[model samples]
Target: MSDTAIEHYWDTLVTPYELWAEPTSARLASAALDLIAPSTGSSVLDVAAGTGALALAAAERGLHVRAIDSSSRMVDRLTERLGSLAGCSAEVMDATKLLYDDDEFDAAFSVLGVMYFGPATMTALTEMVRVVRPGGVIGVVHWARPVGGGPMFLPLARAVERLDDPEVGTLEIPVTTAYLEGPEVEEALRGAGCTDVQSETAVVDSPTPAPETFLAELDPFFGMFPQYRAAVARHPDRFRALVAEEVRLVERGENGHPVAHANIAYGRVSH
Candidate 1:
């Protein structure tokens, strides 16, 4: 996806979840914190800090956190929500090209933010590694697997499959659980000079505002497929009916909750 397309998709589909799913977000963050081994007064950097979820949690835990995201709207929301937190601040910055000195932070982390990259995933990972001090932790969390784990990605996978694009073999985005389960994540960290790498599973609930609201938010990503856009635009009622059915299927297993399974990776850059 183009940068503009990706940005719009995030602004629409994810921004609201940040505001409404506080409890669920907190759970994943607590899991990440458990793996990171943060210390009191540690200087932390949260790259791709959407709505400041992990960053705020880190601050509340007594870590000094400086957070940044590629989306201005997300950064703005984070600032508004976290302004009063003495040790936390949010800024608009690209994860792939961080504007910071090397080894500037004691630890760095990203929560469910790695998959948005369009071929820039490595650059972002390297930048995260570069900013953290040697021996300091670099932690990451991404949605877990086979397209059924994350509700948000399910429709996306279905729509893409409908398009029948051969190149769409798998969702290569960092957010997918399959990406984290493989050896690639550890290898990437090792290539970035991180050692003692480890990753584990965590469940994160992503509650939608309403069915219509959820579908509307997802429209941007569906718009990427011409057939999907035409289907919804031409048969509005049918499109909504389809979404409703999918929602029912999701609610059954989740107890009406949209808790997504994700993987958390943690390791330290070598000193």
Candidate 2:
């Protein structure tokens, strides 16, 4: 999808994205911050800020934060959420091309955001590094695998394949998972001139009240993918079949709520 399409999709889904994804996003943000551990009053940049999950977490810790996202609606939501916060702001900006000066922030981070850059992942990471001070830390959290597992979207991808839409092959979901595999993220940070790079994986489990609720939460994400949308438009019954398969795959947690597992890879930027 083009940048404009991505932005439009995000803007259209902001409400559902926040309702469904914020809790997990918040958990990942907390994990990334724990790894970076910038001092209070530190200047921080949140790339692809997305509803201000990381920005809000940093500001609560007394950090001065500048958050940016490509979707103006997402940025608006973030700004509203940051209302009255003393030292935080959100703006609409492309992650691949940061507008800040070199070494301007004490630290920078993204929570499942930069991975969507696909071929431009390195550019985004480099821009992130360029804006941080010499010894400042850079952190990122991305899925070890696609959320809800590969099969969740495989049917849709296959359908798109049958239609011969080359764009579907480049869908953000698959592209992100493919590019973020293993040491790829760490290597990218290192390649971006960050030193002392380190990474670890953490599993974030979000439990919904029931399987139905779980599927509802996942709906926004499924809708966000252009391939899924197109496939659903063309083959509603097939799409429903895939969704039913997804429902059957969901396992109940110890507490009876449906538990979704997200393997988050956390990387620390070098000095």
Candidate 3:
């Protein structure tokens, strides 16, 4: 699927869920931007630049940035944000099939957008590499495996698995992320014809609401998409209660303060 398609899907689920997930989302975005290290005056392409978080950071670093998101709503919002600044622009575009010509950007970056490609990850990476100047840098950040700390919805994974749906637990290539190591990221870069690939990990942590509060905020997400909406509709009260219970369990063990964390993998491609 195209980046815009994904963004369209996310626009429904994100806002309500974001109300609860904002802390972690901000932390992850900041961490990814730190790894990207955009230089002042650089021409940067921010793939899937939802809501302009990373793009805004790049502009703050004095970079000239053109950001694109598949979701029109996201791009529209980003445009407004960038219109408020002189050095940034936002557009609706796909990561897998970039509208820009080859060697169009000095650097390119994605935060958490790379991993959501389902089966089209390599195609998306190839496009990212193609748009950058030879020797220009490409940086990607994906959430590390194992649903790193917090009250993750292990039950959701289990539910998906039980359904035997191909989309669950696999990338577009059907590669299991459970084996995702730093080297695996390098391999993906190499597979995309990227030379001099290198990768490392960083920690992302954010403060979160109490279990009860968070789950209430999350209720809308369970209905954002058809599949999830069907599942939630099947037993809305039960699913809601389960999430609240898990949050309570997490909070009780830690005095109601839960800090969510994830391992972020950053991979760079040589120009």
Candidate 4:
């Protein structure tokens, strides 16, 4: 299922969402620009641009950017973040069916977005291909796996398992997210007619002011993602306790900050 269709899931997230999410997205954006290498003044497109992370990053490099999201509220939040930035704009639009002309951009990127597209990733990548000029580059970032890099929820999941709580046994996050891999993303980019495909891993440093404060800030995300909803619904008290333990471990290991490794898959199909 394409979870991006859930507008309220994204709409309800704005400043709070960006507070923690942007750090990861920003790291992904840096890796993306390193991959795409768009020069200053090059036309760029950010698909599924949540709070304009990649868009804002590109703008900092002097690239003309147009950020699009399916959620109106996301676009509004991004627009506010982009105040007074010339040659940059944010708008609500479907990523699978981009409302733009062919060969319109020099490069395109999506950071920590488009992975939720699930079956629609191909459509989104195809649209991105159609809109970029021949030889133009496009990339999409997705949560890879637990081996080389783990998602933020990994520690919490372990904490839940260690507690032997029958109520929270086997938390079910979305199937699409649990097993997402770089090879899967590479296949999608190839299926979209992109050549010279490449996939690599990069560390995402997500900052935290303090363990408890970070937990307080992350409360909103628990309601946004399904696995969190499942855990909270099953036994809110147990899950909260589990997260508390995870926070302690995080504090000890990484100064209370969390980190994730994301897959960056990028390629270009000559139009």
Worst 10 residues of 2 by lDDT: 252-261
Candidate 1 TM-score, C-alpha based: 0.81
Per-candidate Cα RMSD to the true structure, in Å, reads 4.3, 4.8, 5.2, 3.3
Order of candidate numbers by TM-score, starting with the best: 4, 1, 2, 3
Model 1 Cα lDDT, one tens digit per residue, 1-271: 6787667666664554564544555678889997676998999998888777798889888999999987778788888888787777889887888999998999998876764453676778888888888889988877656443255655444443444444434333233433556356666667667889987888767665455565676554455555555556555676566566556666676423467677787788876
Measured by lDDT, the strongest candidate is: 4
Candidate 1, which ten residues in sequence have the lowest lDDT sum? Answer: 169-178
Superior by TM-score: candidate 1 or candidate 2 = 1
Which of the predicted structures, 2 or 4, would earn the higher TM-score when compared with the native?
Answer: 4
User: Model 1 misses residue 119 by how many Å?
Assistant: 3.3
Candidate 2 vs 4: which has more lDDT: 4
Let me know the TM-score candidate 4 reaches against the reference structure: 0.86
Model 2 lDDT per residue over 1-271, tens place: 6778878878877876676567677887887787668899999999998888899999999999999999999999999999988878999998888888888998888887886677788889889988888878888877666643322444334345555555444344444545455477777777888777667776575533233343355566677666767766666665456544444454422222233333344344454
Candidate 4: where are CA atoms >4 Å away? 1-5, 146-150, 175-179, 224-239, 254-257
Q: What's the candidate order when arranged by decreasing lDDT?
A: 4, 2, 1, 3
User: C-alpha displacement of 215 in model 4, angstroms?
Assistant: 4.0
For model 2, what is the alpha-carbon lDDT of residue 85?
86
lDDT score of model 3? Answer: 0.63
Candidate 1: misplaced stretches above 4 Å? 8-15, 20-25, 146-149, 155-178, 209-213, 216-225, 254-257
Candidate 2 local distance difference test against the native? 0.71
